[model samples]
Target: MRLKPVPVEIEKGKINVDIDLEEGKTPFIVVYCQGEAKITFLPEHGETKVVTHQGKVKRVKFDEGEDF
Candidate 1:
């Protein structure tokens, strides 16, 4: 299944996204970043009646690091 990309705004040095998922389905997110950037997912989870999604953006660093 091809999921359309959703644009998220950076708020207070962070980003938040909410999407619907069907029950018993495993859903993943595709994060696209421009230029030199890093993304880290923190150990966190939120659950409701049916869906369970985890994590948050920890930090994004764009600096001189080891060549990739």
Candidate 2:
């Protein structure tokens, strides 16, 4: 699946993404900067996956009210 980056506001900076996924496919969110990254689902319904390009990845959970 092609992951697109949407506009996101982080603690210090902003993130922009454009993802291309097939229809019926689950929706996911990925935040990355430099080499570190974080992936979270739409809701807290599923597990979040953390991945690092060379160092470490952090998983964060957000509520629906925090979304746009």
Candidate 3:
């Protein structure tokens, strides 16, 4: 199955991404950024993952709003 890419909005140096996924499946997201970038995932369980990748692109796996 091919899922549509979620829309990401960047405003004032902050990036906002809202994604919806199906249950019992794992989905990955590839984000392209210039230079170094930091990504933070805030889940419903109050667990947060802060990731910093120094490159032009980053690929992260998502499972039930879990960490990367």
Candidate 4:
């Protein structure tokens, strides 16, 4: 199956995607950035939901520490 990139808008730090699916059921791909991200998909209702969170740090830089 071929996946198409859908246009998204970020409002209040949340991303919303609107997709139009053809007749019959199909699967689509969803991309998310790092940090803290939440996702919700509703294929039966022909809609997908995505939520992202900020202000969270994943890694910290150390001067005398070994990088793994």
Question: Whose lDDT is greatest here?
Answer: 2
Better TM-score candidate (1, 3) = 1
- Model 2: colliding residue pairs: 3-19, 4-18, 4-19, 5-17, 5-18, 6-17
Candidate 4 residues 1-68, lDDT tens each?
23334444455555555655554445444554542333233254333433334743333222233345
Local distance difference test scores for all models: 0.37, 0.50, 0.41, 0.41
Candidate 2 lDDT (Cα, whole model)? 0.50
lDDT for predicted candidate 3 compared with the true structure: 0.41
Clashing pairs in 3: none
Compared with the true structure, what per-residue lDDT tens digits does model 1 show for residues 1-68? 23334555555544455545443334444454542222223212432121223544333322323434
Q: Stretches of candidate 3 above 4 Å error?
A: 1-11, 23-30, 35-55, 58-68
All-Cα superposition RMSD per candidate: 14.9, 9.5, 8.6, 14.1
Colliding pairs, model 4: none
Q: What is the per-residue lDDT of model 3 for residues 1-68, given as tens digits with 9 covering 90 to 100?
A: 22334344445555455544554233334344652333333334433232447743434433445446
Total clashes, candidate 2?
6
Clashes of 1: 0
In model 2, how large is the Cα lDDT of residue 55? Answer: 61
